[model samples]
Target: MTGGEVAGLIAAIAFLILAVGIAIFVLRVAAVTKEVKQTVSEVNKTLDVVNSEMGGLTHEVEGLLVKANTLLNDVNGKVATIDPVFTAVGELGESVSALNNSTRNLVTRVSGGVVNTTKATVVARAGQKAYAMFKKNKTEQPTK
Candidate 1:
C-alpha cells in the first residue's frame, strides 16, 4: 500500500474503535435509565398504597374520637345527675352528728341535775318492795 493509504486505513480503524466505545457507553446509560424508571414506578405504587391506608386509618380515628367524646359527655352527665345525692348525703351526716352531740349534751345535763346516788338508791329500794308485794298478791290469788 502507499503511505497515504496506510495512514488513512489506520485513521479509519481508530475512528471505528472510538465509535464502538461510545455506542457501548450509550447502551449502558440506557439500561441504567430503564432501571431508574422502573424503580420510580414501584415507589409511586408504594406511595399510593400508603396513602389509601392512611385514609382508612384517618376515618377510623375520627370515629374513635367521636365515640370518646360521647362517652365523656355521658360520664359528665351522670356525675352531674348524682352531684345532689352526694351533697344530701354530706348534709345527712352533718345532721346526724349534730343530733348525736345534742343527745350527749342532754344526757350530760340530765344526769348532772337529776339522779343523785341517794335518790337512785331510794328509787331502787321502792321498786324492789313494790315488786315483792305484787308477786305475793299474785301467788295468793287462785289461778283462773
Candidate 2:
C-alpha cells in the first residue's frame, strides 16, 4: 500500500478507538444519572411522608394547646372563687381575736370591782365592833 493510504488507515483506526471511549463514558454517565434520579425519587417520597406526619402533629399540638388554655381558665376561675373565702376567713379570725380581747378586759374589770367592794365591807365591820366595845367599857366603869 502507498504511504498516504497507510496514514489514512491509521487515522481511521484512531478515530474508531476515540468513538469507543466516548461511548463508554456516555454509558457510565447515563448509569450514574439513573441512580441519582432513583435516589431523588425516594427522597421525595420520604419528604412527603414526613410532611404528612408533621401536619397531623401540628393538629394534635393545637388541640393540646386548646386544652391547656381551658385548664388554665378553669384554674383561674377556681382561684377567683376561693379568694373571697380566704378573705372572709381572715376577717373572721380578726373578729374572734377582738372578741377574746374584750372578754379578757371585762373579766379584769369585774374582778377588780369585787376586790374593792370586799375590802370596803371588811373595814366597816371592824369600825362598828370597836365602837360597841368602847361603849360597853364606858358603861361598866364610873361616869367619865
Candidate 3:
C-alpha cells in the first residue's frame, strides 16, 4: 500500500481505542450511582418502620393510664360506701350500752322490793305466834 493509506489506518485504530476507554469509565460511574440509590432507599424504609412502632407504643401507654385512673375512682367510691356502715355500727354500739344500763337499773329496783316484802312477812308471823302462846298459858293456869 501507499504511505498515506497506511497512516490513515493507524489513525482510525487509535480513535477506536480512546472511545472504548471512555465508555468503560462511564459504565463504572453508572454502577456506583445505582448502588448509592439502593442504600438510601433501605435507610428510608428502616426509619418508617421505627416511626410506626413508636406510634403503637404511644397508644398502649395511653390505655394503661386510663385503666389506672378508673381503678383509683372505683377504690374511692367503695371507701365512700363503707364509711356509712362504720358510722352506723358505732351508733348501734352506743344504743346497746344504753339498753344495758336501763336493764341493770330495773333489776336493782325489783331486788330491793323483794327484800322489803320478806322482812315484813317475817315480823308479822313472829308477832302472831307470841300472842297465841300467851293466851294458851293463861287458860291452862286456873282462874287468875
Best by lDDT: 1
Candidate order, lDDT descending? 1, 2, 3
Q: What is the alpha-carbon RMSD of candidate 2 to the true structure?
A: 29.6
Off by over 4 Å in 2: 83-144
- Candidate 2 overall lDDT versus native: 0.71
Ranked by TM-score, top first: 2, 1, 3
Residues 4-116, candidate 3: write the lDDT tens digits: 99998998888889899999999999999999999999999999999999999999999999999899778767855765555555455445545555655676687754222
TM-score of 3: 0.36
- In candidate 3, which residue pairs get closer than 3 Å at backbone N, Cα or C atoms, i.e. clash? none
Question: Model 3, poorest ten-residue lDDT window?
Answer: 113-122
List clash counts for every candidate, in order.
Answer: 0, 0, 0
Question: Model 1 — TM-score against the truth?
Answer: 0.51
Cα error of candidate 1 at position 144, Å:
83
In the range 60-128, model 2's lDDT, one tens digit per residue, is: 999999999899778767855865555555455455545555665686787854222343344444444
lDDT of each: 0.72, 0.71, 0.68
- Model number with the top TM-score: 2
lDDT by residue (38-68, candidate 1, tens digit) is: 9999999999999999999999999999999
Whole-model alpha-carbon lDDT for candidate 3: 0.68
Return the TM-score for each candidate structure. Answer: 0.51, 0.52, 0.36
